[model samples]
Each structure stands twice: as structure tokens, then as C-alpha cells.
Target: MSSVNTAIQLITREQAEQGATAKGSTCSPALAKGPWDYDLAEALAGIPAYGPGASSADVAPAATPRQGQLPEAYKLASDAELGERILAAKAALGDRAVILGHFYQRDEVIQYANFVGDSFQLANAALTRPDAEAIVFCGVHFMAETADILSAPEQAVILPNLAAGCSMADMADADSVAECWEQLEEIFGTEPDAEGRVPVLPVTYMNSSAALKAFCGEHGGIVCTSSNARTVLEWAFQRAQRVLFFPDQHLGRNTAKALGVPLEQMPMWNPRRDLGGNDAQALLDSRVILWHGFCSVHKRFNVGQIEKARKDFPGVQVIVHPECPMEVVDAADSAGSTDFIKKAIAAATEPTTFAIGTEINMVNRLAAEYPQHTIFCLDPVICPCSTMYRIHPGYLAWVLEELVAGRVVNRITVAESVQDHARTALERMLAARP
Candidate 1:
């Protein structure tokens, strides 16, 4: 372990030693917490930690080309100008490059992306582009990491801006996950396997670190997105007695709930506590191991918003991603991924309206695409996920210029070790899909 990691691990050990007896975070669960939670120092503290300043296996040297902060870089005039230049650079590189854009991406970058979809779709898309030498990810850092994990080893996945990351995904990490699993074992002995042996599965959402994906792969889990959550969960349940789902509790819970699992069967794992800080009742009856994490964006939607939207547009179908708070999802007529929302809207025979409770960009894009449908975000006011918004056109332009210059900026790479674990988790899910 590096010195910084050693110290952070010391802190965790110190806290574990003292229990809740020491200084506890007294802030309301409502206190705003997001991507700014930097535990880089803590990750460094873990035993067998990587080299200096490394938190996870991802702390690679600055391998991608520099763009945004480079002094001599040419200043592109407008978003359009940047797009033109990016296209020009693509032409310069010729035939070996492809771009993947997330549904939440800004219009400027999305227009330039060769493939646009949610994280699950992007992960699959990357795998199909085996011939491409480079994959430019026009999304958050986790999405890029997912691309790196999914794409062919020879194909390099590039993130235009290193700073673009998901705050929601950051809420859960390795140590927290490890603690939760240990707790599950304590309570349930071991998850029952097909041969009546014990099985432990760790499933991750696409919006997680490459190491987490590696962790999942290592533990016989699969990566999931809002789109394929149901399939992923089914895959997970079949291979193991239970699954330890990270980063998005709502998605895991909601998906499990949808699959006829009772609310009583799901237990929340609080990384900050002993035996995952799970309630006794939940532990005794556990079927799903839910990490105490949620999406700051989707959690903002409440049942009240759905009610208000329904009153405003009667007969409208309230479609939401399962990542939403339970109340909001319960109030909605339907819940699924971006693909589901789009498909649901398109399948409507009657002129329809929709109150979507996911990211605003996807909602707004849906609104524009289906003019026949009266679609609006469930959020009455326009609030975007702050971190996703950080990948503005300026950043996109800057990154593109570096790519065009035959230099990859913000290259996201998953170490071979972690990649093995993360992919195992994902494949397990794929196999379990009903």
C-alpha cells in the first residue's frame, strides 16, 4: 500500500475499532452528498494498494493526450466550430475511430457521437466495434470505464475529459462493498448454490469504477444498467443465493420488487456499520443485498411530482427509470430504462403524454423526438445532474481536438485483473436474464 492508502486504511481500522462510538457523521441522510466525496486518500490506505497516489488500479500515468488545459491548444470558436474540427480530425485519423455518446450527453456531443444510448447499450456497442482502434466516450468517467471494460483489449476507449464523472456512482466503493458481503456471510452463512453449495455474487451497475466491475467479475457477478436491470437481476439470482447490488439501491430494490420479491426480503447494507449496519428483521429474511446508496438525480423525484404531472396531463403514462425513489416509481404507470421509455412512448396508439423521471437530457430529447406525445420531465423545474452537465460542449471540443491531433485525451483503461472480475459479474447477469 502507498503511504496515503495506508493512512486511510488506518482510519477505517480506527473507525471500525471504535464503532459508532467515535465521531459519526451526524448530517441528515438528506444532507446533500454527491461526487465531491473524494476518498482517494482512503483507497490508498488499503493493504495491497497500488503505487504512489493510486487509489484503485485505475491510477494510470497520464497516457491520454492533454487538451482542455493545454496552453498551446487552438481555441475553437463555437460548439459548431469544435464539432467541425472534431469531424475533421476524425477524417484525418481515417476509419479506425468510433464515438459512443450517452443519452444524457449534451446535444453538441451527442450529434457527433456514432452511437448514443444509456450505459448498458454503450457497453454492448463498444464490444461490436472490434475493428476500431479507438473508442471516444462522450459521457461520464464511469461510462468511459465501462467502455474500456467492454471493448476489445486492442481497442482503446478514450474519455475526452478526465474530470467527467458520475457523483451517484461515487457513493459506493470497494471497501464498503467488501464489508457488506462479509456481513451477508455472517447472517446467512453463505448464499445457496445450484448444487446446494454456497454462492456469493456481487453485481455492479455500469456507472461504477473499472475496479468495481473487476470486483464483480472476480466475485461472479455481472454489470447492469437501468435498461437491462431486470435481466441482470434474474441472471444474478439464478447463479447465486443472493446478490450484493451496489451504487443504486433503488434500482436493485425496485427491480427485485418488480420480480415478485417482497419488500421484507431486501436488506440495506450500510458500509459505515458492523454487519453492514443491516436491521435484524431484514437480515433474517434477506433475498437481496442492497447497498445504502442512491442516485442524487433520480432520488429528487417524489410521488408528489408524478401526481402533479398526471393532473396537468391526464391519461399520461408516468414512465420512470427504476433508479427513482420507490414512491415516485410506485406512482408511475410504468418504470424501466431510457430504451423502455422510448419504446413505451412509440408503442402508444393513442396520442399520449409522459412524465419521465430520469435524467433531464433524456427526457427533453424524448420530448423533442416524439412531437406527437406531450412529454415533460417529472421534475417540474429544470435541474440537471450537476456532474453529467460538467461535460459541457467546451470540454467536448477540447477533448475532440486532442483525439484529432492523433493524441488520445482522457483514456480510460481497466486493469486486466479488475476487468476479469467486473466482466464475470456482468456475464453472470447476462446468463440469468429471464
Candidate 2:
């Protein structure tokens, strides 16, 4: 199968000529156009929105960062021209720059990545290249913020597109979280129990903002990734009577469920309502307080898709990201992080059919990598993570060329006040063990 971008173009052309619906493809026709178009519109309209894709429906906060218009030259350049320009710029920058690509990034942008992995893995990879003056993260806003927090002071972390912000991360703002914290404090005081555990310990997923992570750091909390959520939760439980997990409810719920926490013990915290929409008794009895947030891309997957996959391909191994809803995770054969999903397929010896539930880009890449086996995404739609899709090849080329010209654009920097606390929480997570 061609790249999703190519498929979208073809489908769009066919649709215009034949007046036919995209047969098996479900992505919006808007995605058929270049992402730069949306970037320009967002800047002109003075409003921020996750451009066309899975997260298009998500409402971006008014404070959300916006990307400026791309130079017409870059936008007008053909794919081959952009590829050549990016390569030339990379050659000029040499060791001065290192590009990090998230698993969900489009193949066009990922092709130029010095290191490609999940957010945490990419951050660690940037550390390994300490000599590099710039870390170009082709992921979303939160991932770039993470790189800035973890990287050396002199090193600059750059995001290709400022508009490439995670909608899930935006769901839990610093102000909203702080408000929730104050309410929790009123109900469950700062005192520790007889076992010396605090009343509540804050734990923000890696998808959250630096301020939120710093909140965790200052309040005796820790940060967690999808891969290490279990370990982090166990770590939290040992120090506190109850834990507060945020930014991605599905991840928190799924992980806590796996640890045998009763459903009744985990209460969802809605920022809009008082007491997180729960009674005092329920809050007191809660072992894990879940925040109302989720990954829009993962939210698109459902049990129906899994059932369809099973019906179409018998004996297929179904794997989904833990970010998926509880029902979807429960229905799948296994739920793990992106790395876990990739490893599972690599470990398979027999020719197998695999149905994966995650961003379409990574699923498509996996399918291409292992042609011997049959691999397909559970969601037949070509929709990808909206923010990840924002990092188009045009943007990549523009950023690289700017670096070659000794100018830095779209650099992500964490405030000094936020860095220490955020780094503390991250360190606690690193020390946490199963």
C-alpha cells in the first residue's frame, strides 16, 4: 500500500472525477489538501484548531500555540524537491542537528529522522546525541516540551510545526488541574495516613504539559508513559493512599484495571463539575481518580472494528495501544504501547494476520515493513493523529533550511521555573521499577 498521503491524493482525485465516495477509506477529504493550507488559515483566523484528521473535532483552547504561514516556495515545492532540500540542509548541519521522529509521524517527514521512536525513547535518544546543538522533534507540542526539559541547556529543541499540539494534552490545562488539586486538598488534607502514605499523589501522563509535570514534582507525584504506567502507578500507590492520573483517562483506567483495582474504586474527575462530579464518599473511597481526557485517535477505535477484523481474518492476533477505551482494550487479544506492538509483530515466527489499533501511520509503516505477514489497522479509515499529521514534509524542509541559514525557528523552550520540578518527576519515574 502507498503512504496514506498518496492514497488520499488518489482518492480525492477519483472522487472529484467520478463523484464517488472513498470506497474503503474513511479520512476526511480535507486531508487530501496540504496541511499548510490549514496552517495559513489558523494563523489568519487567529484561532487554533487541530487540522483535518482524527482530532479535527477536538476544540483547541484559545491559548493554544499557532503556526505562521509557510513560505510559498516550500508549500509549492514538489515532494522530490522538498526531499532534496531537506537532505541538503541536513548535510550542511551535520552533527549540529539531530531530528527525532515519533512513531505516529508521516513517513515523508520520518524519512529524515536521525532517531525514530516513541516520545520517551526519542527524548532519551536526544540525550545520547548531546553534542548536537539542536533537537528537531517531529512530534506534537508536548513531546517537544519534554525534549526541551530533558535536553542540555545549550541544546535547542525545535518542532517543525507549532500547530502540531496534542489535543489530549490540551484537555488538561494547568489552570484546570491546579483547580482540581485545590479541591482534592480540601477533601483529603495534606496529612499522611498511619502507613505514612499521603492522602493523594498526583501522576501526570507523559502527554501532559511541563507545568502539570512540575505540579507532580512539587506535590510528591511522578510522571508516566504508556509503557511504564503500571510501574508508575505501583510507585504512586506505595507513597499515597490514592493516586490521581490525568490527561488520558483510557490509559489510567486500563492500567489500573490490569492491576486489579475495582471499577467502583476509580472515579472519573471532571474539571467542569465540583468534586469532579463525584460525591464526598466516592472521592474518599477512590483508589485512583481519573481525569476526563483521551487521545482522539485512539478514541476512534471500537470493539466493532475488532469484531470486523476477527470476522474477516480468522486466527488474527489483535493488538491495540493502551490509550484505547476499556472495551476496546478488553476486546483485543493484547494491549500495549507502540514499542510493544512493534515487538509483538517482530517476535511472531509464523505467517500471521495482525489487526492493530493505533495511529494509521505507524500501522501502515508496520504493514509495509513486514510484507510476509498480513497486517492491517482495525479502523479502515485513513485518519491519522491530527497533530502528528501537521508535521508535513514542507514544514520539515523549511525548518531544516532555516537551521542551515543559522536561524532557529519554532524552537520549544520550557521556563526555568518549571524545568526543575518537571525533571524531578521524570527522574522519579526513571527510578520507579516493577
Candidate 3:
């Protein structure tokens, strides 16, 4: 993973508290909301976070090292020079190339994107450009894989930085999931209920790999994004006795909890241990079996920070993404997907104060866009999505230049077998959208 050269300086919670106290003010009340278990500053350095039982030793596919040792020309070029080169390459390629960027991407990279949006929107954005010969994705690896699965076969999906990957996605490997599935079948059996619903249904979050999505589709399951998680789960329940949700425990738990599923009924699956460290009885009674996975950036946000923001600024509207822990999501004013957060601010007519609990890059961008409102991150520390920042302007320029030279660089392709099943899951999601 790589770090972005942005103007924002991310600090730790402790550092923020000390700085505030030195200014003759106190915001520690918010800091007291939850335990600051990890160093928030490490997020800016592009470090991934593992779940309770999952370790780096779990051994997923290694990330491509695009961030290491840039070419001399790119290393020496100024920001302006790189920006000009990117623009020139795009102009030369014309309609043959299309650049898609995630909202969490840096301004430098986002500026070059022909379409800028969240994951769901970017997936659909690729579909809208079938005439494009190449889709240059300025996001993480899985996202590019998704675009490849959804886009036309003639379209080449390229991730500018191959090293860019989701920490949460890496938590659940295909082999571990396969073993878990076998164990689950052994306990639950392959029979359907009286209503003709299967004993269990597999539901994977969009942040996961194409292979995982294919697994879900092959097993009569569906893929879900944060925006449509609730709907996808509802769809799953219609045809299954219980849902096996993976790659993002928080989203599954949060959505299930809201739908009246008790916390006691949601058991976490620790891939490193047998039966996921749970007894058979608990597994039998479970409604949503949560895989041990979480977003490092969202997990860093604490309720203490939210409470402190409210204490410092009166009537502050606190908003967060559903990927956050249930406690933090519950403590905030509202929770939704990234697009929802952006719209919430856009819909406000009067000047407002917002305390957002998501990535720092999006928060900072929103703050700049909505000058009328005082928008700041709930987490006083600056922690952008490390993987999202891996798509630097230099990489963007390099890929675009290659495309202009009648060459495709860093193209991502899914196997026909995997693509067929992954597309099935994605199509289910599109149709299941509320």
C-alpha cells in the first residue's frame, strides 16, 4: 500500500486531545466513548487491520507492488507536470479509455477520473460505458475485479496500482470460507425448511474478491453493498433459514440488529479456529453468522470522538457509514453509505455543523465542497483509506500514457468460470436493489 501526498495531516486520538488541551479546551469526553485500541496514525501509512482471530498469517493472495520505486521521470515530475501528462494522455485516448475513481480517492486522482463515485456507483458506471475499450479504475483491486465482471468483454479493466486491496476483503480467504462452508453443511444439513428455503444462504459483501462472490452465486446467494445490505439480507431470508454473511461483520450485524436479530443470535466466525470458536448449539441458533472482518479506517472511529464533537460544537449532525462498529453507528446521529452521507450534507439548506465518521479523504472533500457548513471528521485524527490512497497521480499518469501508446497496463481479468458466477451475484444485487 502507498500513502498519498495530501495536505491533510492525520494525527492520533491522544495527540489530538493533547493539542486541544494545550489550546485551553477539552474534548476528551468524546475520546472516552470507546477504547482506542490501535494507533490511528498507522491508517495513513496504508496498514491493514485484522479481526480478533484472523492474523496476517492466514495467507491470502499477495498484493502487487506498484508503489515501489517509481520511474525517474515520475519521481522527478511536479504535481502539475503529472496532472498535465494525465490530461494529455486521456485526450489522446479519447473515448477509447474511461477513468473511474472512488469517492475516497485523493483529489489529484479523482480529478483525472471521468466518473467519480462510491463502489456501487462505479460498478454501474463501467456498465454505462460499453463503448470504452479500456476502463482505468482508480480504486482498490476488488473494485477493478468487479468492473471486469460487470463490463463488456471487450473492455479492459485496469487498476492503476495493483497493490491496492481492501483489508476487510483479505480477512476471508477462499480456502477458509470453503472449510467453513463444509462445517456449516455438516451441522445444518443440505435440506430445506417446510417453506422450501435452504437451511443456510451465503451472503458476501461487495468488498470481497471475485472468487468469493462467485462462491455465493454458485450456492444460491447474492452480493451486497453497504447501500443495499438490508435489502439483500431480506432477499436471502426469503429463500433460506439463516444467512452466512462474510468479509464485513459490522455491516451484517448492524443490518441484522436493525431487522430485529438479537446480538446473541449473531456469532462471529474465527477462521483460524474450528467451528469458528463456537459451540454447535450456538451455531444452530444463529440467525446471521458474522465473519471476522472489518474496515481498518471505519474501526478507528470511536464513540468517544462523536461525543466529544457534540460537546465541542452544539447541535452538530453526526453521520457515519454502516461499516462502522454498531456502538459507534448507534451513537451517531445517523448511519448510511458514503453516497448517503454526501447527500445528507447536500440536502441541508441552512449552514450546519457536521461530524462525519468515515474516511478522512471524503470528509475533507465534503468540507471543502460545502463551505457554508462546518464539516469535520468525528475522529479528530486523520486516517484516510490506505488502499484507496494507493492509486497515486503518478500511477494514473503512467497507465493513461500506456493506453495512449496503444498498450494496456495493469489490466485486471476474471476467469470465465469465476466471471460467470460473479456476474450472477452482481445481477442479483442489481435486481434486489430497493
**76-195 per-residue lDDT for model 1 (tens digits):** 354466667777876776668888888876565677777898877887887777898888887877788777777888887877655555655766777677767666667667647556
lDDT of 3 by residue, 237-289 (tens): 99998999999999999999999999999999999999999999999999999
Superior by TM-score: candidate 2 or candidate 3: 2
Top candidate, metric lDDT = 2
Q: TM-score: which candidate is best?
A: 2
Against the reference, the lDDT scores of all candidates come to: 0.68, 0.93, 0.81
TM-score of each: 0.79, 0.99, 0.88
Alpha-carbon runs more than 4 Å astray in model 3: 1-4, 8-69
The list of candidate 2 runs beyond 4 A from truth reads none
Candidate 3 or 2, higher lDDT = 2
Model 2 vs truth, CA RMSD: 0.9
RMSD of each: 11.7, 0.9, 6.5
lDDT of 2 by residue, 19-44 (tens): 76545564688988888889878878
